[model samples]
Target: MPHRKVGSSIHLSGQLPFKDGELLGQGVVGRDVELETAQELARHAALNCLAAAVQAVGDLDRVRIVQMLVFVASTPDFGEQSQVANAASELLIEVLGENGRHARTAIGVAGLPLNTPVEIQVICTAV
Candidate 1:
């Protein structure tokens, strides 16, 4: 429910790693969550972003990712934010091919909603 269209662009709100309303991973990375789990969660969140795009645009084939922002809930010493984000990027490319290549920013945050370790926000153009 966190997607909206503006002209030719679709903006998706931060998506957590939930499938069927089940949170896959929780807590801060390097504190209560492992790197591998965080990576998987990132992929899941990215999928959710794509799903929202599909909802707004009606087809995955017509959507091209323009930019993405990944948020990681991690401890002070955790510095692998980019690696965690890579998982999401990889999924996008695998799913959408070249159109999925996008400008991206990965950030570490103290916390996120529902204690989820990974969140992804996507902006796409309906082509």
Candidate 2:
């Protein structure tokens, strides 16, 4: 809920995969974080993003994903940032259908805040 208001839009911080103050996917994304786990984390991150958008505008139907950036906390050997990011991508596609299709950037990082395997920063616009 701690977001910035900007002329019919609200900016949100990067969404984390935390539940009850506990971080999800504590290890590296491409190593300890399995495909399913990464996907789940991605889904959770997308949901969090959508939730923020909805809360800001008070209408799920009017929100659209403009872009999303996914950061994978992984080992240097990890090379599947796209796959990990797909978790969030697929979920958004499923939820919002065609409107969910978005421009995205997925990259691997040495680590993420809270040590979560995946972190998503989403940009949305209200219709």
Candidate 3:
């Protein structure tokens, strides 16, 4: 529950996909990871960020998204990073309307915690 504010932005702790006794899967390889499946995973990771945002600031309606960074575990041959990230981008836009449209970086990383196929970090301006 710790937060730091500097200028017009708030930095949040790393968040992950989880629920009561459950978590998004791990051990996914990018080459074998379907675009839709990766997208779904990205969506889940984004939802986790939303949960963190709500917990940190108590609302989403007042948020104006500024940036989102999505990291994916990639196989050497996998090249659909941007497509996979669309899921998170679309979800935010769907939930936050114009406020959700923002810059994004979709990166293919060697690996991630829990081996989750995707991870998300969001930055936004909050009222």
* Candidates' C-alpha lDDT: 0.95, 0.81, 0.78
Worst 10 residues of 3 by lDDT: 12-21
lDDT tens digits, residue span 1-127, model 1 = 6898888888999999999989998899999999999999999999999999989889999989999999999999999999999999999999999999999999999999999999999999988
With candidate 3 superimposed using the best TM-score fit, by how many Å does residue 21's alpha carbon deviate from the native? Answer: 4.3
Of the two candidates 1 and 3, the one with more favorable lDDT, higher being better, is 1
Q: Give per-model TM-scores.
A: 0.97, 0.89, 0.89
Error of 3 at 60 (Å): 1.4
Model 3 misplaced regions, further than 4 Å: 1-3
Write model 2 residue lDDT over 17-105, tens digit each, in one string. Answer: 86666666688865777877987888887888888878876888887777899988888887888998888999888988887888999
Candidate RMSDs in order: 0.8, 1.7, 1.8
Q: Compute the lDDT of residue 91 as modeled in candidate 1.
A: 98
Best by lDDT: 1
Q: Which stretches of candidate 2 lie over 4 Å from their true place?
A: 7-9
Task: Output the lDDT of residue 64, model 3.
Answer: 73
Over 1-127, each residue of candidate 3 has an lDDT whose tens digit, in order, gives: 6345568786655555565546666755556577787788788888777777766667988777788888888887888889988989999999989988989998888988887788788787787
* Residue 35 C-alpha lDDT in model 2: 72
- lDDT for 6 in candidate 1 is 88
